[model samples]
Target: MIDTRMIGDVRVTRIHEYSGPTHDPKFLLPDLSQELLESNREWMSPHHWIPLMNKLILTVQLWVVHAGSNIIVVDTGVGNRKPREGMARMHNLNSLVLEWLEAAGAPPDKVTHVALTHLHMDHVGWNTRWLDGRWTPTFPNARYYLPQDDFLFCESGRNKQEGLDVFGASFEDSVMPIVDAGMSVMLKPGMEIGDCLQVEDARGHSPGQVAFRIRSRGEEAIFSGDICHNPIQIVHPEINSGYCIWPDQARKTRMEFLASSADRETLVLPVHFGNPYAGFVRREGAGFRFEPLLW
Candidate 1:
């Protein structure tokens, strides 16, 4: 079933692509503490962590927000039939993101805008589709937004993604097609969409990554894409994901976002969080905690 919720009149839903053990805690998150995991097993077991295999569970899902007359889809998960290498789990696969969107009542062509947090292969795969040997924009009628810095860096072949053979084709397949189709709008750090949405410069995971903030009727929510890959990072905010291009900056941005979420009581929805992919951040000692929320 498609999980639905509302922050004022904005109808929000989650369209999942895949949900399972995407990586080992040690490999993806280099600074995970075994001691913390063992102590927190009572709450983390079977949901966030698989202690037996020492694997961290994650979800690749899309956040669909229906605000005013706009249907904004954030961070499309890996789509079907991409020649993904190195990243074996996401390589050349089929996903139910579109079907689930339909079930949730947000069909493809009806989507007015599609926004990406960054240009990573996993995050932007659905921006285009493989059709008749050509990569094409999957959302034919939607205006796509991408971070200007990321688009430039990746296009220059200087970004970390370019060095990795597996993601070498990502820029061409996922980003260029949108730009070529005249559907991509390169945005800077602080662009606001109407009065209900804005971009937060949350770099680190990528050289030019950003997060989305939405507000309506005095309520607030943030789509914090890839800042914190695991629930453990809420407590150990210092840990950097293997994919982070700017580790120091990523950690700093993460800390700031978490603090803000805790203080403002904003609903923090992440792209790769499991099941109840969102929650409220709370003060827990010197760090913070994720309070899973479902609607």
Candidate 2:
């Protein structure tokens, strides 16, 4: 299923890719306590958490924004036939992302800009596809906007030795092809795209992770990449997903982003979150809470 919302004149749609019980609660969030999980069970159950399986449910999706003449796709989900040797769930397989994209009104050829919040296996997979026996840019007409620090970090081979399959192989297949094709633009902090979207520093989950702020006609929303994998994080802002490379920074960034969203009343659209994937952050007592957007 696809869900869309209009922020003024810009039409933003969430294209579904994969959704299931992805990780153990404690494994995904080391700080999670049984009490905390029970406290939020009323809202998190079924959609965000599976009490029966004791797993945290996550969704891998793409956020396509239609602003004026620009059809910008944010964070492509895992593509077909990628080598995710360590992650069995993400290993070589076929996903109907392209068809989903087409159904959502932003096909590969029609996409004008491809903005990546960060360079991770799941987020960059569809950036390229197997074409004519070689990996090639999926959106031939689009210019990909990649985070500068991540590009440098991945290019340096620093993550090659990391046991987790977040970078090395996927980088070569998904990202490098775009760079080699000269269709990549290194995004910097405060970068603006078409005067509608602004890139802000949202690192910590990955070296150069970012969140895009979409503004139009006094309405606003944020394409928050992985700042909070699950809505539970909004209630417990300090919790970091197991995939987070820099736990401390990740927590700090999440807390700040939640507070800012609550204060600004900005719609928060995270890449992962089950049903009602986007929401508004509400300040609750010492922390914050997620008010899922029904649309």
Candidate 3:
């Protein structure tokens, strides 16, 4: 289960997963390739890696006001039976995500929208469910938002040509189900679905990756979906992950995101971090740090 916070009139719910030690160590912010290559060491010890309070890693669910009406889920995590073997071992999808959603009072029908930050498997798994031996969009009444660039990248020869069918079925089974049902829309950056929520292109992890910014009653927060995996990356913005398609581009994107939210007033919702849904970016010694929101 996760905590729920209200920003202005919007009730922001965070569905967290205590996926300690199950995730790939490399995905940790300090283990990014750029940071690894710069340092001679292979990894950081547990002492150096632990958070200030010795906390564990926590993933988040960002629920924004749906078209200023209801709620929209951003980036559903790995769902059940997602083929988690070998390199993808860490990509396991359990029912807790959906359970947490229900616990937070959001049933499958309650979620009216699912915004895919990118076409990555981990971000899109829960977009659909396995039913009658086929994958189908989880939300019947909701529309799935896909960035045109990301859709093309995934559907193109990128994964299939290499015989890597990890996230392929998700688009076809989960996303396309909604699309065929007329519930999916290919969106461009800066598209406004409502008065409160807006999509912005923060590409680089993927060609057309985007982030959602939700503003309500003079207070605003950005659902930074996978742009930076952990808080440590905020301090070491130059780091690049192995999955990063373009290292340089990813770096630039992260920098821009940091700059945009560096101010104390802005709430940054990092999709995968230990705790605190929103945080204030602060200038530390040589780089920036994420100061988690107290409330």
After superposition, which runs of candidate 1 have C-alpha atoms over 4 Å from their true positions? 160-167
Q: Which lDDT tens digits does candidate 3 get at residues 1-295?
A: 5766676767777776444433444544434554442342222223124323333254545453434466688777767666556644334455577777777777788877777788776677777777888777777777788888878777675756645354555676556666677777897898965455688988877778888887778777787777877665777788755556766898999998888788536688766665555578887676787677786
Model 2 sits at a Cα RMSD from the real structure of 1.3
Candidate 1 lands at a TM-score of 0.95
Instruction: Give per-residue CA lDDT, model 1, range 163-266, as digits (tens).
Output: 64323577888889899989988877789753456988998888778988988788888889899887778877998888888789999999999999999899
Off by over 4 Å in 3: 23-68, 87-92, 160-169
What is the TM-score of each predicted model, taking all chains together? 0.95, 0.96, 0.83
On the 0 to 100 scale, the lDDT of residue 234 in model 1 is 87
User: Runs in model 2 with CA error above 4 Å?
Assistant: 161-165
Measured on C-alpha atoms, candidate 1 has an lDDT of 0.82
lDDT of 2 at 57: 92
Highest lDDT: which candidate? Answer: 2
What is residue 146's positional error in candidate 2, in angstroms?
Answer: 0.7
